[model samples]
Target: MNVTVFGATGAIGSLTVAELLARGHTVTAYARNPAKVPASWAERVRVVIAEISDVQAIDSAVAGAEVVVSALGPSMDRTATGLPLVDGTRHILAAMATHGVTRYIGHGTPSVLDPEETPTIQTRLIGLMGRTLLPRAYAELLGMTDLVTSSAARWTIVRFTAPKNTPRQRHLRVGFYGTTRIGFAVGRADIAAFTAAQVDDDTYVGRAPAISH
Candidate 1:
């Protein structure tokens, strides 16, 4: 499989690229900052450095990709400007359509509720905090969520809560809210593992599962 990763410089995204490589998949890493990519991955992965808003650059990145994973995360910065994540996702989807790519795995929070779910305590608190403290980002994430779910592509929005800088918990509890017991925190490497595997796994298509340790 040819997998292209957006936000490849982030903590989880970097891990995802490596995971894909380890799984014998060709990976094209899309990152804004070249310095953030590891020196070790230089020879093993294809690197694309450009702003998320550059439609042409984004299209180029998704050109021949069979699977597209967006590890683009939201920020809590109140001053964070614009809907770059949402808009960049729109561009990615369009580019995926331009080519023949169908599989899309993206990241979101529990605050972006799945249609079948009722709000849980964690979701309620997260929603309250997002609406109060991170209004712009919350709105933007919702927009991004809308685009992915409503798009023509096969999309899986992996939702989570606290992402800890811990070792991979190979065992994970994954389900929608109110349906299963899930913890508030999870390991970043664990997230990368599950997300990268989605390229070949169709079990979660059209569904957003909250994953945690």
Candidate 2:
């Protein structure tokens, strides 16, 4: 499989690249900062250095991809401005469509609701905090949700909250909010594992499944 990962310099995205390599898949990682990418990976995977807003760079990165995974997300900043992720996502989806790529695995939070989800205390609080505290960033995330779900691709938004730097966890609770009880926190490693696994797994395609330990 030829996998291209956006936001590859991010914590979870880096792990996803490693997991994909471990599972015998070729990887193309798009990194904004060349310094953040490991020198060891230079011989192992293709690295494209470009900002998310670089349209031609993004198009070239996804040109020959079979699966695309995005760990791209807005920082949890209350003062976040200019929906960068939303615009970047729009370009990414357009590139995928032009390149004839179908599978897309992206990241999001529980605040981006699923049709099957029923409001829970945890969910309600998440929504409230997003709107009250991080309004701009929250809106950007929702904008990303709208684009991903509406695109012509087999997409999966791996949703979670409070990711920790803990080791990978097993038996993750993966499902919608109402039916499945999920915790507020999960290991970043676990999230990466699940995100990488999505390249070959269609169980959650066209659905956003919140995963937690």
Report, for all candidates in order, the number of backbone clashes.
0, 0
Mind giving the per-residue lDDT tens digits that candidate 2 earns over 47-143?
9999999999999999999999999978776665799989999999999999999999998879777766777888889989888988888888899
The lDDT values for all models are 0.91, 0.91
- TM-score of candidate 2 on Cα atoms, chains taken together: 0.96
Q: Which stretches of candidate 2 lie over 4 Å from their true place?
A: none
- Model 1 off-target regions past 4 Å? none
Candidate 2 lDDT at 125 equals: 91
- lDDT of candidate 2 at residue 194, scale 0 to 100: 92
Name the top lDDT candidate. Answer: 1
